[model samples]
Target: MTTIPVTDLLGSLRSGNSTAPRLTWYGPDSERVELSGRVLDNWVAKTSNLLQDELDAEPGMRLRLALPAHWKALVWALAGWQVGLETVLDGGPADFLATDDPAGAVEQHDAVIAVALPALAMRWTGELPAGCFDYAADVRSHGDVFMPHSDPDPSACAVRTQEGRIIRHRELISGFALPHTEGARLHIPADKGLESALANALGAWQQDGSVVLTHPDVALTGKLLADERIHGS
Candidate 1:
């Protein structure tokens, strides 16, 4: 299979089919949110900017993502890769942490980013700890276009998995083990955990395909399959 570099994959998403929905989310209470390629890129750029500018994140720094398998979590992973932070999915020690529970994540990281998972959350619902950065509140203030201070080192570690595997930046696409479905709208179940979700999403996006991510509580019925035009799972 032909593989594109992680950065190049993101570039294609932004420039190739900017208006088409790249990610569709289905949550509880019949809540649905969709992000087109351009919008997804914009969100990633904003988050990347926030990481780089606000947190002083640089290449090789570890970013432990304590988020669930949701749209926002995917955005955080993509942004971390964009800014060259080593994404840690093992709940291990790291330079920074992006999580829904800031109070629980405060002890081990240099900084903590509180994430609000609701589709329309303008800010964190509760009062955050004194030093925590509220993702919803601070991300919008950053630039939509991300200009990295320096190019990422391809040899640097990109992902540190729970099973103690390390995937380097250059290997992310080529080493991706998921089945590829070109131009297919794939459905990814959230119960598979964040790493699997991220891997599947990356494979879909790499092939100019899209993903419909369903929250664990959202059942995958025939109606949903037909409505989302899902071709694969």
Candidate 2:
């Protein structure tokens, strides 16, 4: 078994369990979205292409994620990491910012992205700032398979936060001792921050398993949990 970096884990999942559910998301409006490993990888690929081709996003670029704990938000974060961009959670300086609110972005950002968390809508339908682009709309035109323009050094910094810690891809993946194996379906709450939630979810994926994402805001009963076949409480 080869110990691959977190960046390569998604590709492994796509090839190993292409049709399995990689993530199942529920919105506050009782809307549900299920993305298989292949589908999720397609989205990530498209998003990476959008960032690299259109926005001129390069590896080592700092990106601030201002979206909520939605599935698309996680996809964008993974896409950024795939492009070798550092995902900044701590309100630090960033080269680009992806947010639901254009006004919330800092003035120093070179690019601003508006993400509309649409349940069934494919793209954002509202107006945006002159320079800001709608993520959903723009990503539709990109290719489904992404090829990195330039490979990044694996030992280089992959993520940084106001926590004053920088982590590399190998370190982040190796740090978590996940017990999930291939096709494991793990359930997690949305109360966790993006970093924590993604860490656990990706850890599950690291084992070639999928994640059943849930939220405290959404009413979840024992029946619903059982219906999803969630293994544990």
Q: For every model in order, what is the number of clashing pairs? A: 0, 0
Q: What TM-score does candidate 2 reach?
A: 0.91
Question: Pick by TM-score: which candidate is best?
Answer: 1
Model 1 over residues 1-233: C-alpha lDDT tens digits? 22226678889999998899999999988999999999999999999999999999998899999988999999999999988889999878899999998986676788999999999999999788888999998999999998888788888889999897999988888775365778979899999999999999999898899999999999899899999998645
TM-score, one value per model: 0.96, 0.91
Regions of model 2 farther than 4 Å from truth: 1-4, 104-106, 176-183
lDDT of 2 at 63: 82
Distance (Å) between predicted and true CA of 59, model 2? 1.1
The residue pairs in collision within model 1 are none
